[model samples]
Target: MPSPNYFKPSHPPTIANVPELTPYYYDNSIRMSPMERAFFTKIAKKDKSGMVGGSDEAQFFRLLMHATGAKKALEVGVFRGSTTAYLAQGVGDGGKVIGLDITKDYLDEVDAEEFWAEMGVADRIEIRVGNAVDGMRKIYEDENGSGTFDFIFIDANKDDYDAYYEWALKLVKPGTGLIAVDNTLFHGAVLDKNHEEGRAIDTLNKKIHADERVESSMLCISDGVSILRKK
Candidate 1:
């Protein structure tokens, strides 16, 4: 079910320049009670920043998983497993997610078993270390792999998004597959011609929008996200 406070598409909430509002957004979207919010607030206030999985981007992934009944998922950047656990639980124990990260610094901050125990769906999660491309390749070449995924979240290095998208394209089947790219808006920098990040994301957006291989929607939510459903 959609959270009661889900900021509508027409009236999207603006993210601040810092991670100050991120904790609030994360707890808010989880639909927690006041006490629960306080608990998360404590953890969030101690957060100095650069925590990847707790961003609003994670909310988008969770909704996508539920909306499309996505049982198989791939997260290119798994920082602290915040989004990984969220995605894994949303689809339940029957689903699986390949959590790929270049390093485990953020993931090691919290105990995986403890986190998964709370989620009640930890068995479905798989953690992999390496670059996104290598991790993706390993999954595809697995002997018992289906070579098919219901959803793929590209939140890795900005420079490698294009490569990730291209690689993911070959592994999906039409109609039931969803590919979502995060940080495409680059915190509204994409609108400024002076920002290099803007130019890079702008280029990716146009390319995917024009591609006939998939049907797409560009959502301005949380740093700008582009969602493509394989045609």
Candidate 2:
């Protein structure tokens, strides 16, 4: 069973009172490629775990990559590679995306490599399956200490957020890289004291706010996305 505070609002009461979405907003704001649309449909049909982020979140990630001119990216949780596809699209043919997941089942289930090839980005992504912390370390070492990525997306296990943040800081470019973390709000469970996953997220949120190395903001976008730009 879930805790009572699982769905409680973390935002102020006034803000929480606002409608979740409006027709005007939905009609005018979102955009997706045909490939992206297909990916969404595929996930809807196959992904029963509900691990994928909404289209808005995926689009935001792509926008951030384009806005930053991110040529090299790292995605901590590849899930079904939906976000990876978006990242690849944002970076173009010359860029690359390094994806890490704890298991290969999701990647295989989604036929990620085949999809990337179909999208004309197979050469741009390298999928690694194992402990993300170890993978990040290997990546740092393999790049000869200079493979700093321009953008990073973290959406892995909530308990490892702090550890991931530490590695993300090390892997990202010192001044311009962006690190975006998904599920910081955890379905508003962050308000609950007893939820371990929520507590993990809440801890990372506080840490990011206090950390002087980055400028940060938490948006109410799908499940909440916390974006940090390194100083």
| Candidate topping TM-score | 2
Question: Model 2, poorest ten-residue lDDT window?
Answer: 8-17
Candidates' C-alpha lDDT: 0.71, 0.84
Residue 55 in model 2: lDDT: 75
Candidate 1 residue-wise lDDT, 29-58, digit = tens: 656435323433443644534435344566
Best by lDDT: 2
- Candidate 2 clashing pairs, residues 3+ apart or interchain: none
- Candidate 1 local distance difference test against the native: 0.71
Residue 187 miss distance in model 1 (angstroms): 0.9
- Model 2 segments more than 4 A misplaced: 1-15, 20-24, 145-147
Clashes within 3 Å, all models in order:
0, 0
Error of 1 at 207 (Å): 0.7
Q: What are the TM-scores, per candidate, against the unseen true structure?
A: 0.77, 0.88
